[model samples]
Target: MLKTLQTIVVAGALLFAGQCFAVDMTGKVVEVLDGDTLTFESNDGRLFRVRLKEVDAPEPGQTFGRQATQFVETLLKGKSVRVKISSVDRYDRAIAVLILPDGRVLNRELVSHGLAWHYRVHFPVDPALRALEYQAWKQNAGLWVDPSVVPPWEFRREKGARKPPPADPSAMDYNGIFDYGLIGNPDTKLFLWPDCQGYPEDSRGFAVFGSELHAQKSGFKQSPGCSRPES
Candidate 1:
């Protein structure tokens, strides 16, 4: 039994190690599905659908959506690129970061050109890449041209929920709002306060109050509040 347990532990450790390293694959871009998705043909002639890590592109028919697709097409279509596959997503599509023959990272380059937004949760935080994004924003490149552009992830969530509009704008509270910007769903007034004990998710109105200097301004206390109403 001891020996068997040791073998199992060793196998687990090896599997974990393998997952940490990048799986390198060279392929030709056969299709630019969108800003963040593409199909590439490997040396073995198999096509793999890849999702670019750490960048979210505009969806079809969305503002700057067409422009994002066009930009990606210009950069990669019919071109040989290298992919460092990170993992398979829920759809079985390979999540990867593409590398150009000239050594530019496609993920970072896309963000630099304002064709994509940094997916902060998944993408490695690179100061240089972020700076490039800022530069693109300043220059009004691609999607940055639209100053009111929303992130694709947030767009999807809002579209999925199909929630009703807030009833009272003036009555809306903004307290206890920690990590205000990190909340993905802009439509939902919910904020995830990381600092609060138990770190509960509170409504945006509640968070606004919790966040305010005068806690008395909002009826709610500093404690975690109720979840925001749907939509």
Candidate 2:
């Protein structure tokens, strides 16, 4: 069953990849939702929420987020452009490549200006995009000016931190004092204390750490939703 599931996943990925290159359309920008998303209307007046392919921009609340959106608006608002449709994102936006009148690639432009990151986790890394990001990083352009710039993905995760069910009282352990081992989710790279409300009852796929420091050393960060106990 595990092998079958893997096969299904691979097939689905290939199907989506093929769909990405299967369509092209021309549209006028109707709205600028954020740095990475826009609403465009085709010649026939059908609207599509378009997300720039392979570029992850900062969320509105992040540093340079507003500047990135303004930049896009300056270049695209009320303008017509050609779109190479990729696939529909989970939010129902059309993932696409935008070609400006001057022949600039909008996705590349955002990265070149330090307004976005290459969406390497979701899409294969493009050498050009990586080079642009590095150049921007070196120059301290846009959001790069911030010393501790958090990736939009990480920002979103921390902002939307989940509140898991309270840890069961029966699960407590001690050595004269209450001892609550750290619970780490390797997938999310987040760890929670046993006393945290988000701590899990089931330990099936999680790793138990001897301490918060141990979890940190193992590349796990404390869950933002979980508060630390006084030391």
Candidate 3:
């Protein structure tokens, strides 16, 4: 009797630990709401709004948004995934890392495919995510395929229009009109064409501008790379 009681106690403790870290469970992904959101059914028959951890994909109106959603749709195909439950968000969604049968981490794969951002705030636990993002930037994968890019977070803040890809990243003719972002301050704006050698890196604190007029309006005076004397 005592041995049975001990086994029960140990099992309960293991369950608690799994809850604190992450509960490993298999679930059929019934819906791919977006690139980063999904609905799944647990084996035991519980439904959950599963938010993919550590990646933020573009919103509906943002550039490549639909493509990102479609990317996940094509990947999942209403199939089952091994969900490692992380934490629950305020909306009661079971945030998790969904894994494919082939051993792909869905969250990492999204970022690797340039379909999402690493969401560094929620994911400092893994620097590999940051590396994946950087690699995507370098490879010009997905949205980064366009040099003048705005992160989804910045897009939400500015509510700006999405611009088309640069005609040519390697060309020096900026034409004073660009569909991407340029950053500068009151003194001088540092506008690098998407193909410019020193365009968007992971560095923070610089503001992104969609147009030359917008940059000028914001007091970002174009000295060199951004403008030419209107000849």
Candidate 4:
């Protein structure tokens, strides 16, 4: 029994180590470029432009854009943070999750405070962040106070519609059938209706289920966004 327990403990330790990410470095935030982007300087005098992963705050043209920047600037500028570098984005920004001085994850905090969005394009939606965002919406916090609030993603999309050509019939070959169900946020272990407010973006991916039975057999539970039976 003792040998078996030791083996189990060693296996667990290895599993945990495999799951842990190596933080590239720690730094002092020197600039707040926007709600989701910033500049930081490491102790060794290296500077890096870092983007807060999984949080997409508004652009300056959108409503509450200034407020979002201000919120991030107030909390992050001149603060000590640890950077868990994930990957470098196309723009050459270091994709990272910042652990702030308060021991809170900055990405989650911005979404929690209604100052930013839970971006699904780069990462899966965290359920706690989803719930916090929902609560902020329910309480009419910040951007949520705007009843006609268009999400940043939607707002950006609409910006392109200001002057647009009519859809070509040839390019409009999309089928009229709507036979798709979603298994959203592999991290949150939840599924969402495609139209749900917190639906994961296509970049993060949604496994389309042609039938509900497929969704069930694949171990995805229906989220509240859908009217499917919760069983």
Highest lDDT, which number? 2
User: Candidate 2: global Cα-lDDT?
Assistant: 0.72
lDDT of 4 by residue, 105-184 (tens): 98888888788876655224566776777687677788766554556765675682332322542332111111233455
Error of 2 at 178 (Å): 37
Put down candidate 2 lDDT per residue, 115-174, tens digits, no spaces. 997765332357788788878877878877665466687568578333332265333221
- Determine which window of 10 residues in candidate 1 has minimal summed lDDT: 172-181
Residue 129, model 1: Cα distance from true site in angstroms = 2.6
lDDT of 1 at 106: 88
Residue 153 alpha-carbon offset, candidate 3, angstroms = 1.6
What are the runs in model 4 whose C-alpha is more than 4 Å off?
A: 1-21, 122-124, 160-231
* lDDT-best of 3 and 4: 3
How would you encode candidate 1's per-residue C-alpha lDDT over 38-120 as one tens digit per residue?
Answer: 87667766566778986888888577788888888888867788988777665656778899988999898888888887665
lDDT of 2 at 1: 43
Worst 10 residues of 3 by lDDT: 172-181
**Per-residue error (Å), model 1, residue 189:** 12
Model 2, stretches more than 4 Å misplaced? Answer: 1-21, 160-216, 219-231
Candidate 1 regions exceeding 4 Å error are 1-21, 160-231
TM-scores of all candidate predictions against the true structure: 0.63, 0.63, 0.61, 0.59
Error of 4 at 128 (Å): 1.9
Ranking by lDDT: 2, 3, 4, 1
Q: Score residue 203 of candidate 3 by CA lDDT.
A: 34
